[model samples]
Target: MELDEAFRFIGSKGPLKVGWYHILLYALLVFYNCWIIGFQLMGMIFIGHVPKNYQCTPPDGFFTNDTTPVLDETTELDKCHMYEVQDGIVTQNITECLYGWDYERIIGETSIVTDFNLVCGDAIYAKIAQSVFMVGVLAGSVTSGQISDFFGRKIVLHIALVLKAVSGVIMALLWDYNALVASWFFVGVFNQAIQISSYVMMTEMFPPEIRTISTPLVSLIWGLAVSSVVPIALLFPNWRHYQIFISVICLIGVPLWWLTPESARWLISRGQIEEAEEILKKMAKFNGIKIPNSFLSDDKEIPLNEDIIEPSNKGHDGENEGEVHQQYYLLRAVTK
Candidate 1:
């Protein structure tokens, strides 16, 4: 079947174009894709990990008794150094937070920064992990897009969802810093794959009119979630628990992935003609409408053959008319 023919047939169908169910399906797909928005921004909390106002941990028994001048001066602590009394005399000395830095518990109840000692000289490691995640995202975007073009969107999306969930959970539990970083990169890779597949499928399933409206409307929720992460992180005080929370939440929408139908564009391009027709018929029933014969058939099914598409002889002087038709239908089938 020709791609434009399918679009034109659906668009011309009076009942399908105005049907409430049609709008609902498009809206639901948008919501599905929007889940990525909040989850994507969740990385911000980890990346923005900052040490709370930290001071050199006090010596043992420094707080055992009532306030002393020795304690009083050290009360106003500094970042990497603290004060102490030596040999019964008040004196200043260099300290390395050898007892470990103490936090004021300001930005979060706990963070990777404090929990993992990703502070002082080790602060760069957390930032490096964040940067590595983005690098993985970049790599996945290019590779997954190419693979989806060859295979299909929905299958790639499903694989990505599973990989993302697995990697996210692994990242949460990993104790080794390098291993955790590696896990995060895979999480990011699958995250990009899921986002891109869903996006392309959304545009393909819906008409241009629906695509125009649904795209930004769905993104609105993502924008809101960006601000909501701060408050959500407040609910998970420890970085380990928060990471677990994020991973668990990532799976909440997995079942919904099953709700979305595979892209007919992909099916047709792969020459799954019967499957494509079945999807079209299912959509017609759900929309409470019928497909026009031009796209399908009330009499006999339209063969998804190149011969079915006529050459654009009027435009190309009949020289590459067959080529023009091939380009027109298959490109639409591949891209729709």
Candidate 2:
């Protein structure tokens, strides 16, 4: 029998019989993926934060009183330029900061701006780093779905999770600006891959009714996770430490390689009927339902409205079934 027919058969049993398996699956796929992606997507807000107050440092022995450079009425000692002071005389001549900048620790103790001295003339690199990461996200969104289809959802998800974690850690430890930018790009790529693969796997696992609700539920969880970044960022003020903290969270998903099953729909699509049956059997067992012996048999043409092994609501009538099918197709198209 086709996998869609099998899902319809099981779904007719009602939520009580299927809720257990979906609860476990949702925990592994939706909650975890959304949480990690939330932090990674919004991480730049803190990581690339520029201090509110910054000014060019003066040369040693140039200032005897307050180190603030004396500026004319029109000019001020901003991050990029400082006034030249000689023997306590303020000069009108303004010069680009030859010395580095000193930042007030208003936002956090340190960020990419302070760590790399990204203020003054080099400030644009901060935006460039974020833009590079976004480009990786764009690239991943275009490619990850096809990659997941060619490979399998489980393998792609696990691979992306591990690589995303590694790249984030690498980004944290990177000293050079170029290296940090490159690492962040890959982090964005793997992060998007994780999002796509997990989302697809999640929608495939649920029946049509639950699947309709699941999309919004995942979005709500993701919004909550995104909102959580502020408190978590406050806890880890240093950018490197904040990054490492989120990277380590990604590692928590590694064990799901063994804990969760591969997409049965994907397996059926690949003609691995036996493997798909095994996962379905596991789901039935967890959900306290049974699959008929002939459901997966090759000799028999499985009936669409066959009586479920366990008693529940009657199967949908032909007319209701058609409507359900229409709604399912509509949901599928909307999701795609």
Candidate 3:
């Protein structure tokens, strides 16, 4: 008999819904998504790009919000122009941030902009680096979906988590700009890969009746992470520290991926009958429900349960239009 037949037989004998074992597994899965959301949002923290507020560099003292070094008090503090007292008259010396920028630390410490001097002429690179990470997200989503379909959701998730963790940590520690950009791409790819795999497992683990309801539950966790990411990121001093913090946080889910059982349906579909049966048995034992030994012990012929499949009829035209009437007749006959 097929696994669905077995599940139906078990369902008739004992309840499969609201089991403690399943609930615990689902709870872990939800927690995993929440952290994944937080980690993804942390990627948006650009510490080098500090808040823009500046004044002309003073001849002696530093340029500040309240005060600036100037030759004359009459010349207004120019933001984009260099103030030069030419012939006792203030004149614009068309220039950019020549003396470098003084950043505001109100939101957080230095961003990638300040760390790499990503302004004046090098600012576009920062934007490109972020765009590359976004591209990785797209690539990872497609690659992970195909791999999970071929391999299995559990194995795919394990690969993704490991890859993401390693890449994220390396991204934090790297000093080279080019290498960090590449690392960011890999991190996006693996992070999103695991997210997709985890979501697929979440939907498949539950019964069809409850699967729809579980959608919003995962989204609720995701929503909570979205709301909390900004505040949590602020706790860190700079973008480097924030990156390190989120990378460390992502490691917490590594063991979770290992502990969680492989999807039973996926195992059965892949012809790993014994492995599928083992998970089912574990769940049954944990839930204090009994599964018949006959259904699991032997490969010998077992009688198929009749309740799972109802007879269907086709019209003379080879269509299923007559199915309702045929089912009605069968029901009436059974009632008699």
Candidate 4:
């Protein structure tokens, strides 16, 4: 019997049914892909927020608000420029802020913008940080697939998770703007790797019939995770605390390394048939199904006749039959 046929048989019989194992695995994958990925992608919205109310710092004796006139000719207060003031007379000459900027705590207590003083002249660096992170994502997306294909999904996922968490924490603690940007870049890289590895591993383990539903379900989880950023940001207004909070969340998946199983199909493709059979047996036992001794034997030749095989509970129309055959051939191609 083809590996795909065995999977279908196991799925129909009960081993691959939507049970506790499936639920646990799906939950882990959702947390890894949706929650972690969403936070990493959307975190910049809060971290890089530029406060609207800020102006150049006044001299020790001068007190000025955002609307305070810097130049005698105009009533506008420049955020990046300051004018010398003596008594009640303001100097006509305007110069870039020499001391620093004073900001109103209207948006939040702290952000990368406020912490780094990324205003006016340095505001572009905020966008640069975000852009650098995206470039990391693109690089990770390009490379992680090949790495996972070689090293197996579970290990790569865990490694990426660990690295991502470390990078996030480092990003929060970094004092230098360039160092923070560099750390955020790695966070983006490993975040994408975790998403890709976990997602592919999850899909490979699930039955093809369940995949259609699972895909949209994963998306819904992702949307929810993304939407949650606002409330989370509100709760942890400080950028450092927020970064640490989300970074620590990645560690939740570390214990899952023991609970989750490697993809049986991946094992089979790598010629580890004994390991694959063991996992299958465990799956069957969990679902209260007993497999025949010949189910995975090399000498056993199972017929492909549709009449002999039981139809799926979802009903196997011509289209479904075609899909099954296509999957079987695809598996064979991969194995070869």
Residue pairs in collision within model 2? none
- Candidate 2 vs candidate 3: the lDDT winner is 2
Tens-digit lDDT track of model 3 for 1-336: 455444433343233444676678777766656676456645465543545654444333433432333335666554443554445444455454446555556765766766666654677888887888888888988899899988998888877777777887788788788998899899789878877888888887765656777777787777777777777666876787777777666676666765689887788677677787788777767765555453443543333234433456776888887554333222111100
What's the lDDT of the predicted structure labeled candidate 4?
A: 0.76
lDDT of 1 by residue, 1-336 (tens): 455455544433434443444465566555445654355547547544786566656666664111122334575445654555465443556545556666777655765567667777777887898888888889888888888988888778877877777887888787788898898888778888877887787777766665686567667767775666666677776676766666666665578665667788788778676677777666666654455432432233333334334545544454664564544433233222
Taking the tens digit of each residue's C-alpha lDDT, what string does model 2 give over 218-267?
88888888999999899998989999999888887776678788998888
Instruction: Tally clashes: model 3.
Output: 10
Clashes of 1: 0
By summed lDDT, the worst window of 10 consecutive residues in model 4 runs over 326-335
Would you estimate the TM-scores of all the predictions? 0.74, 0.82, 0.74, 0.83
Worst 10 residues of 1 by lDDT: 63-72
Deviation (Å) of 183 in candidate 3: 0.8
As for model 4, its CA RMSD to the true structure in angstroms is 5.5
Q: Report how far off residue 123 is in candidate 1 (Å).
A: 1.7
Off by over 4 Å in 1: 4-25, 46-48, 63-76, 83-91, 106-108, 292-336
